[model samples]
Target chain A: MKKTELLFLKEDVDIPYNWAAGRYGSLFLTRLRDEGKFIGNRCPSCGKVYLPPRVVCGPCFTPPEEIVELGDTGTLVSYSVVNYPFIDPETGSRRPIPYTLGYIRLDGCDTYLSHFVDETDPAKLTPGLRVKAVFRPREERTGRLQDVLHFKIVD
Target chain B: MATKVAVVGIGMTENKSRWDLSLPGLYRLAYQRALEDCGLKSEDIDAVAFGHSPEYFEGVNHPEKWCGEAVGALNKPLFRVHTGGTVGGSVAIAAYYLVASGKFEVVLAISGNKLNETSSAQIGLSTVYDPIMGRQFAAGAPSAVAVQASKYYSQYGYNEDHGLMVAVKNRNNALKNPYAQLRIPDYTLEGARNTPMLCHPLRLADMCPTSDAACAMIFAAEHRVEAITDNPAWVLSAVAVNEGINYVDRDWSKPIGLRKAAELAYERAGIKDPRRELDVVEVYDAFSVQELIWYEGLKLCDWGEGGRLMESGATRMEGDIPVNPSGGTLCANSIGASAMFRKAEAALQVMGRAGEHQIPGVRRALGHGWGGGIQFHTIMIFGKDKP
Candidate 1:
């Protein structure tokens, strides 16, 4: 067999992304990391609670004045079992396949928190099913949605 | 007051993954056809309005500089607009304004996205959300749409079967549209349901396939509309609006921005009853669920009744208000070009040139697009007779 000589060059470029959590996000993450609790801002004008708290309400265009502490328990507004796998940018690895994700409307809050659902069986995951967030170990807490390992059925 | 504007010519590339062609080639493919259709040369165009989503896919900050030459806008005036998914529709509206202002007699509006060049559109879409808030849960468009689908399904008592009909209908419709990316001749409800589930209530078939395509349309002032072609799609009204991204306060199922934009367009067009007056529609159905949601938001039906409306076969090709006669975004999603494709399809319907997908005696058509975090919306109305 004869081999054909070929020349190839490879170049690698790294573009780093740094984002500020801002006032609402900074406080929300700080509380989650320190107290292991979820906090939301309530719009006084329309009386709507925002998860991961927004500085201002979208509809009324009013700045929320009250930051409300919310319970870890909530109802699953919707959920889906991931039958496909894709790259997870966080760890630069593929997200585990067949995992379940859920959107939970926390108690006393109007907005739904989208996060990983502990249950993988689609039948068990139903809208309106009560679930509670399970926090990761204190040492492993990351002050992010991952701070809570996943949401499990309250029952 | 704005001067009257009309779409006198349109050109669209086949909606499929064009890995062989560069971004500029794709733009030229459509621009050349549009120029030929209007029997005009490159120099005849006074200005060019380009549209597309974020520049992440092209791996460039300013894409127009790379693609504008294809449309012959080397030194002449050029405008670019990017409002997420609605970039295409926004471009068309901008071109309409350029002509309506009487600044330019002939303006070419073009937009497209070469999704095949990107790694994965999902990854690109995932990075668009808030880094701290919804990033973790946002598994791109399908996941976001799944959330909307779940909310609508629960609130309106609709199920996957209702959405399946839309999938089957659009896929079947694609069979008639030669440029569509997805053309399934044997498409069925059961077949659609059999597709792998990407998210809860959303299957692979329920989502639009990312394709490489460009759509170009020529907008002319009233005098030029008469001089260019007698069968022009008169632009009755074009309106764009945006709501806040906070899904907490707004209903995800029925987008307020879409409804408000439709109202503005209808009011300006003197359309009392859209369901009764409009002959056809081309809505941004990136997902099947959005198609149903838009039916309600467009006031084609009452709120929470879109599911029933879809089941009624009212929006089918042979139905009263045939929507997506060109297979819609669900069949071929070129992201930036998707909205412009809708506008082009609506214009084709008004011109009575939509080949096999043509609805008989169609007079008026509506084109819609939704973008941003489901916030920005654009609605354009087209009529056969000059408005």
Candidate 2:
């Protein structure tokens, strides 16, 4: 009789990546992280406003020229009150239920921005409800959408 | 019969890691250059055809939508086309068709990718293989092509020197191209052969570098061609062919799709003998061995004699039919845009606009794009005189 042992070989590979925010994305994100200020870019040719600024306006095919400060308060056009537990794709774990998501039309901006809302009750969430951005503290803020922790119903 | 069309403008950004510009911004730079080169405004472009590498490389899905305005396709019609390494070639063919069909008088075609955006483009390359049957063998592009080289060379009883000679020749030629990223000054055959081997037959020097680059070319109808440029590279013929990857009787050593495409392009262009008639050529040589393999596929030489052709120096700068006068994809490869540069460089040669890399007495030229596990092949022929 003969005895044999099975062996296994394992190796790990690491891949790192860096993403550029581009010219306009950096400006909006920088103002959010540095000053807790909301900003949007205005198209030079069409006067259209873009939040989380892009290099150019799609409809006009022209570069955005102006960076204007925007009010933190906005009207909630729509919202969803999620009551079921689900996996958070960004964290790879179960996310807490009863979270609220909303599309808010910010003041002086032509486009709508999506963000998390503090309210989870569908009864309290309504169209045209005024919401104000609540930002993270400067010490904890990174130049990303998460810098603004969430939006709270102000009216 | 389709109307005659010609290349009126060509724009290519420098090949390297461009960390500063966003993907859309990078695309804008190429389109802007093309517009300036042809003395045309955004309004002049009737439509836009765009292309880039897989979304897995940059994680930007629907890149054409994101870059529509960047290439001046705001209100104008625009569409995205992709075929892996031959994406640019497909876009070029689309533009030619758009103009030659009389649907558009002027068409703008832009293709490329920010390949450096990903940590490992090889990771994206690995996904192209069949998941159930072949994914376990998916190590990256170089590994697959190394086996391809091994199989082809084994069939011919030749060693790795032929591939190394191509690497050395392209590196020396890259010195003349300003947009080349890996230009090694006075690179020699000894230098190529001595480089560390990555796979069995492939070395570090044999493969192309990942780059963040874009290329744009404008195709104009014959009626509108003179208004755009005094010199235009007339489109003699263009063909694209693809084979199913079932591998029923597949042999990568002999690319059947490329052979068919080349045969059709030559037939349409009235070229009887390619090696003697064509003045110059730009074939997508993503790896050194591909240059030799494509030589056979392009009918520059017969099968099993590709190695012998390399030994004869018939594909060199001083050869009868000079290949890769702009250093080809071996010098600069941005995946999506790499193949278009071949077509653009060939057009540049015909238009006498290839700068220092231009081969002398180039009246007829050919551009080839090979891609997608050797399944997709595209051939475009260029001539100085209108057909």
Candidate 3:
């Protein structure tokens, strides 16, 4: 007799981390949530403004002192559209398929931000295309990079 | 000593994130710079020594495996040393031993820490504490140093202002140091005083900024020194000591290990007095108060008289003896290279190669590095004339 299906037990992993985002992380997250705008940290040594502000510049090994405000519009560097189905770790459910993921360089940053894009079409989702971040409503905003819902293609 | 050794070449990369270069590339730059400094070929080096801060900071253990070739260790014996912040100093001592033991005629020592690979070095530093007790409160280095600062202030009858003065002085000095990282123009005690306190008795201004930096020094036997450079910074003596921590009778201010290291270094260097004989000095001041405390540990001043020594302008750039003329760990602290910079700066001063921050007429100079719960201490003395 042939087996119809495989048997398995499914449960959520109960690991909880009281993660400290550190000084730079805390500053970036709080500002993203409160102002609904991106702030950049500039490495004083090599003059690069990193995305997801960090304490030291990876290239120069120097601490960045300058805080720069960034525009919402950016250029999509490279991207891939999801066609395969996978479980969403956040919600414990199958994530919607055919979602576009892009690495975008914001107007004033030297580093790229990896996030979702609204455009799903491979043709429409062109490299070097201008994109703008779409943020969650003020009341619903959480202090996270997810505060910005996704990037929408711009003309 | 079986064979006399002298530092023939020194190379230092600017302390910063160094985002532009790979870890191997950074090591290569410093090694190449050192080779160029003394006109040495890769074939001239017989051995290489590598040192770096704990692997947790960069999330890469045994960086020496790949970095060894970058420092000209290919087909040569490589010695790797790691002693927390004093890794650089220890590497220098290791190279000295390699050459002095008659085993190697020419040796190159390299040390650095790329702290940016990890999100926060504090998270890596947090793991350095005693897991059973200290890990629970894991504020990392700052919390421990703050307590030390409080103890020093309480014992010496000094206040936060003393540290503020050191901060201002070092930052101002950094303006003259082309390689220094935190060159705050027109830095003043008043400005530093107003900066918000991160921990008690510790202002944000009083702390060392972390950088991804590397330092390289080439040591050669006396016979090989003339071919490398005309004026070699002769190593007079090098000493490393460690202090045991005690919960019952702990006193961070006294610094027993540093005192013992200094005493041994001075004795072996045949120096009667450090203040008068040493023309320049570099001490690992990871934090501002540590500089003052190190003054006592180095015997530049009596215990509790470090604040007074600073007040007397003895360590100022234009004082009786210049301390941290290169802006020191205060301005550019690359954890692995931080302590090594102390030795390299002193060597540069005595060699008359220290550019903008060069002190006039430096005959003898001293470098000091301390780390690992303030337990380990390394002291190196260099002289213009061979001992």
For every candidate, the chain B TM-score is: 0.98, 0.98, 0.98
- lDDT value for candidate 3? 0.82
Q: Ten consecutive residues with minimal summed lDDT in candidate 2 chain B?
A: B130-139
**What is candidate 2's lDDT per residue for B198-305, written digit by digit as tens?**
555667788898888999999999999998889999999999999544232245578888888999999999999999889999999999988988999899999988
TM-scores, in order shown?
Answer: 0.94, 0.71, 0.72
Against the true two-chain complex, what DockQ does each candidate achieve?
Answer: 0.42, 0.01, 0.01
| Residue pairs with clashing backbones, model 1 | none
Is 1 or 3 the stronger prediction by lDDT? 1
Residue B102 CA error for candidate 2 (Å)? 1.1
The runs of at least 3 residues in candidate 2 whose Cα sits more than 4 Å from the true structure, single-residue gaps closed, are A1-155
Error of 3 at B20 (Å): 0.6
Q: Recovered native contacts in candidate 1, as a fraction?
A: 0.46
**Residue-level lDDT tens digits of model 1 in B1-387:** 777889988999999978657788889999999988888889889999998787777666788888889988988998989898999999999999999998899999999998876677777787788777767766777777777787788787888887778888899999999999999879998889899887777898898998999999999888877778888999999999987675674567878778888889999999999999999999999999899999988999999988888888999999998989999999999898999999999999999999999999999999998888878898999999888
Question: Candidate order by TM-score, highest to lowest?
Answer: 1, 3, 2
Specify the highest-lDDT model's number: 1
- In candidate 2, which residue pairs get closer than 3 Å at backbone N, Cα or C atoms, i.e. clash? none
Tens digits of lDDT, candidate 3, B70-184 = 8888888998898998899999999999999998999998998888766667766766764421343325576567657766886667988999889988898889888889988
